[model samples]
Target chain A: MYKKPSSRRIKKFYAPLNLIPILDSVFILIFYLLMSAQFVKIFEIGSDLPIMADSPPSNMKDALNLTVDVDQDEIRIFTTVNETLYKTIPLNSDGTFDLTTLTGILATLKGRYPKENAIVIRPSSLIKYDDLVKILDSVREKGSGKSSIDLFAQIIFGNLGG
Target chain B: MGLRFRGRRQKKQEFYLELNSLMDVLFILLVFLIKNYSANNLNIPENIVLPHSVASKQINQAIVIQLTSEKKLYLNDILVADLEKDKELADGNIITALYDKMVDAKQNIKYKAKTLGDIHGTDEIVNLLMDKNLPYKYIRKIMFTSQTAGFKEFKFIVEGKE
Candidate 1:
């Protein structure tokens, strides 16, 4: 006679995982990150000292050589190649530099001379650094986001009185 | 009746707070924070209000030169000189104290590069953090000094205008 196979049931136990300690550690980590986080974004604008070359590069012989002279009352945009004065934008009636006009003029120049990438910035001794940076922002590019275009990206710090 | 009441009380179910979802949310938060964490060690001084710019170039590790609104100069967070006194000490357009400091910094960088077996010296870049209200004369002097000390690339640290 064949014996019938005995059926047995295995009991499985489930244990709760301890999470209080993990929660404490996570809270500590979050607090530390929040304390050390940089809330404000910091960035850089690069400028180079004019190269001490005897002659201009062959490709740049007829370049625009754009130069911007910033003063307390007015900003003069001119070309160093032929000393051609492009435009002079004066401060607004509210005592602020007219960046919109500057940007418009820069965009026009960029359209006419698309290959010219260098811009010489000569800020007067009286011009504040803040104002100079505003001028730089206006000169660096036009528009924003996807439609933005670089006006003059190669920045050179012109001489004190040049 | 008292034994029957005691048996009923003993049969009451135990309650537990579920935490798996909270743990999952915390893990996601940790990953997000870790992904966005930046290792830049540049510590902006409280007295120096950086100029705002639209330039998007991220700042890199380099020798830092800071000019506070009070005309104080700092090299890598160490108070090195007072600009007011240094102006009188400047030789022509170069600030003597800053020039000497930059020379020392360059030498230190070169020495470190040599120890690391780099034939060319480290990048000749300097990060300039100047107070927004500072006059360009001071900045000119600093740039001239740094140039004379063999630093060719200048990065002006600015607050990002988003």
Candidate 2:
């Protein structure tokens, strides 16, 4: 230390101070915020619910409505106008829903009827909310052979009974 | 080798700290985190497990309703009603208490908009944050109550994936 003082007194020039430790601390802080940040992606599924209006119901009662019936063992798809069944897909062995077939069917239906954008999801009272959400996810989008696109995005939450 | 080392040591008597490479790595990490970090202010309750979806749009400013797994209703994080407490309330597809709560919320928004000179359009958007395992009856009741509360447009808050 004493020898360094003599050399400093002789030399007029000195090296600049190192700021690496300060930079290191700031970088550490930045990393903490980066890792702790939620950065969550929140998406919305838009729907229009029936309001209590002063006027009577509109003439659009004959509108094309694609209804999905959620059952414990099977999921039934059909149209309101024609009460005939469109398809019957049974649940998986583990009791979880199978959306692969649902996606294919909806894609074909969407291709045929591009104007029909409304899909009413009427889950049974016994069905779990998770299953209801899974069904909605399946109908919300479809693959168009080339790329994935939105299917019946207008999700209508059906009320009790018909 | 000893001769070469002695010559090199004599040439540079000053101590040099090489931190440029370490700083470069830290800077790269900070940039990556900053790019992907989303500034989300959505204060979803810890107990509320949002449904998952492949695609969901970013949430906008709206009336937020949170329903926990216990079938508890929360308006803007305020606990308004607990379905488990009242069996009668759970039986009906439309909940009157929730409707009243929403009406109050709508009135507050309307008053704020009026004072601020901002006009809300014909439709009012309601954001829903519901648990993934609750029954469909509770969901239907919530939707019906929201409709009765005078909100026409609705948005479901879901965990989004790219």
Candidate 3:
């Protein structure tokens, strides 16, 4: 017992320390961070396309460009200049969008602002895909694709699109 | 042989220390680390196979959206886009609401130029994150919608888990 107590005192005073464990812990921490981090790519939302009548105008002053708003049940085309909906077309239960009024209004706007190349399209989150496609086609046709309405155009998608 | 046996016996002094408690502590530490190993970091879906790029640069951001194999869109856990658009999927209102959110983001960028990257990160470069199965028609529709809503610089996000 006396020898055992003396040996314990010697161990407490002069025991050798091992550093391998500390080094192992450090390596593990580094590996963990690397494995847990999403370092390669980012995540993004898939946004749906929107429909509109006329192409967007470019470089225009405030309230001068045409704004097309596509709501859940209605397609509203209004002139920012006049501050009123020039045409409001509702979505048919069958899902086919007849924007004859919207087309005429867009033609009128194009004629009025012949050089205007910017048009803003704001589509609701719940508009049908086919309907949205039809609207985009109409807008492109009216713009003639000669002038890019992209100069000042804006396409706004909803929560679904975000 | 007797001398060798004596030397061996002398070297092998009968001393034992119970390391069971120390092993128990090590096991507890190992379990703790394993439990914390998975932090539920964002994972890119298997269906939305991102386009491969020579550029392996990483983009780290908080919000991420996922598009599935069937084209069902998800934002975090919210089902943003209905997969079954066969019935009727008019997304005008969706686009409008999305536009509002984007505009808010843009406003934030304008307020803090440092955060402008947030606007362009995914909005301007979307092609980087598209699966080969994605149709060109879908891409065009999104482009038209974005242009209509005033998004000049756009981003396309794809899977990146290299």
User: Which residues of candidate 1, in runs, are more than 4 Å off?
Assistant: A1-11, A17-28, A59-61, A160-162, B1-17, B117-121
Ranking by DockQ: 1, 2, 3
i-RMS for every candidate (Å) is: 2.3, 3.2, 11.5
lDDT tens per residue, model 3, A42-158: 432233334444865463255445678877667787676665677788767775566665666676677666666556666664554335544644553444334633222233332
Task: Please write out the lDDT profile of model 3 over residues B51-129, one tens digit for every residue.
Answer: 5322222443323344555766554444555434732333342334333444554445455546444443333322223
The DockQ of each candidate is: 0.60, 0.44, 0.09
lDDT of 1 by residue, B1-162 (tens): 887689767796766799989999998888777766666778999999999888888887899999999999999999888876666754368777777888999988888787876553355999999999999888888888888899998999999877
Q: Give residue A13's error in model 1 in angstroms.
A: 3.3
Rank candidates, lDDT, best first: 1, 2, 3
- RMSD in angstroms between candidate 3 and the native structure over all alpha carbons: 16.1
Residue lDDT tens for model 1, A1-162:
996655534455567888989998998897777777786779999998887788767865568889998889999998757868989999999999999999999999999989888899888987899988888888899977678889998889897422
Q: In model 3, which runs have C-alpha deviations exceeding 4 angstroms?
A: A1-17, A34-162, B1-42, B60-65, B86-97, B100-128, B144-151, B158-162
Model 3 compared with the native: what TM-score?
A: 0.37
Q: Which one wins on TM-score? A: 1
Clashes of 2: 2
